[model samples]
Target: MKREILTLAFARAVSVEFIATLIFVFIGLGSALKWPSALPSILQISLAFGLAIGTMVQAFGHISGAHINPAVTIAFFVGNQISFLRTLFYVVAQLVGAIAGAGILYGVTPANTRGNLAINALNNNTSPGQALVVEMILTFQLAICIFASTDNRRSGGVGSPALSIGLSVALGHLIGIYFTGCSMNPARSFGPAVVMRRFSPAHWV
Candidate 1:
């Protein structure tokens, strides 16, 4: 019975991670795709990424902690919030889900409107140094929020973790959007690049 429960837990965890990643990629990238000129505004796009994250956390928090972002997972792993094995599996699941999400978006949208799967890239105006600074700042804030909200021992359960995380994601996008479209998460960047085969210079390690 113990072995069975362990197996079940592992399955549930990966499934939760996969589904959350899928939702995150779908909503975030969907908003960035080319649409009718009258489509949603930039704020709306930011909010979509934020809200998708907020709700997904609530929906999958128990089974997987609903990371849905590789950067968040890596940070948590570094902080000892999750096991190394779990982190490895989480990253794999996230990448797979992200690719699946991008593929789905491609199939649903018009060929011309696919928008390169919303891959993040440094705009022409930004210097490489500026781009690096931008990503560091954006991800620093995001990591700080994740550490705070999910640190149950520290926060003692104050506000909603989902809300906090989503807000961080939106905040990063607000600033990083102009520079890098706010990757904040490597898996978010990876899947689209793999799908579109348009890896940018910044995408290289």
Candidate 2:
């Protein structure tokens, strides 16, 4: 375990997780902010998040597998695709990166536009149980897509895994935004909540 962790490639992968997550959170929340010029639409926010994840995946997938979300990382581990230590380190890195990204956005954004930093919460009177199920189904689809697209054991072409994964995220948001603000990834929600210093009960769900 020690030898594995000490390897240069392992260190590089961990670092990439942090950097990729930081960028993902920064752009995703930045796009959702309430600008003085105009309020961002749901389609805009969904596409922004999708584009951010897709771009990061394309850029860093080769380096670290680019699991920007903790849920995806955990899912990979649960599926026996990665070791426990790797999953643990990746989760920590992603969380730290998310907080750092949200912090930086908080610093750069105008105060009036911050508006909770796009923190996920229960919307449309969604019950915690209902939101929980919604989140599970949405995350399940994304995780399955990630696993299917990136599985090296596959022989045939997958046709742009990054785009597939990204569109999956956007597709989730299209329905999820009306429910729990679309928290398919725990890190995505946790980061902004920590930065904003507030979290609702549904956040736990």
Candidate 3:
């Protein structure tokens, strides 16, 4: 008997994770990028990130559960909702997707307009400790929102998982952008940094 990991369904999920994360990063970072026309506002970036997430969730949630964020994948694994092997594969796929997305955006964007690939960085006034706390709190909320929206045991009370998850991501960015460029999802932070090869001291945050 073959394990579920080797099945077609598992392969499809992994592929979707890669594609979804790639598109998500491309759109999310593309929004924050400083264009020759005009710089993206915080609200613009927030909505872009949120919309990207919502679109992806609605598009792929059925196949891969749309755990676009590694934090969400790990959270599911930690809660015993997913197998460790599945979590590992999904995280790997997402990370690779993110890097590819950032790379593609970099290639398409003008050199002068490509400002640091909109990489996440700590604010001058913000210490690593402060950034860590902010990341934790914001990510925790996003994770909780994802969990609640995706839970199957609920008796039909949950409404619009995609919208709920997307809005939660936007809410995180509304404040997180000021501190750490709002990386509730580490893959979101990691993609541009790897592509740009520009890692700040507090890049982990």
Query: Candidate 1, residues 66-173: lDDT per residue as tens digits?
Result: 989888888888987777778888999999999988878888888878867788888889877888888988988988997788776773565988999899999888
For model 2, how does the per-residue alpha-carbon lDDT over 72-148 read when each residue is reduced to its tens digit?
Answer: 99988999978899999999999999999999999999899999999988876778899899999999999999989
How far does residue 153 in candidate 2 sit from its true spot (Å)? 3.2
Model 2 lDDT, residue 194, Cα: 98
TM of each candidate vs. truth: 0.92, 0.97, 0.97
Every candidate's lDDT: 0.84, 0.91, 0.94
Residue pair clashes in candidate 3: none
What residue pairs clash in candidate 1, if any at all? none
Candidate 3, 179-204: lDDT as tens digits? 98889987898999999999888887
Task: Specify the poorest-scoring 10-residue window by lDDT in model 3.
Answer: 1-10
Best by lDDT: 3
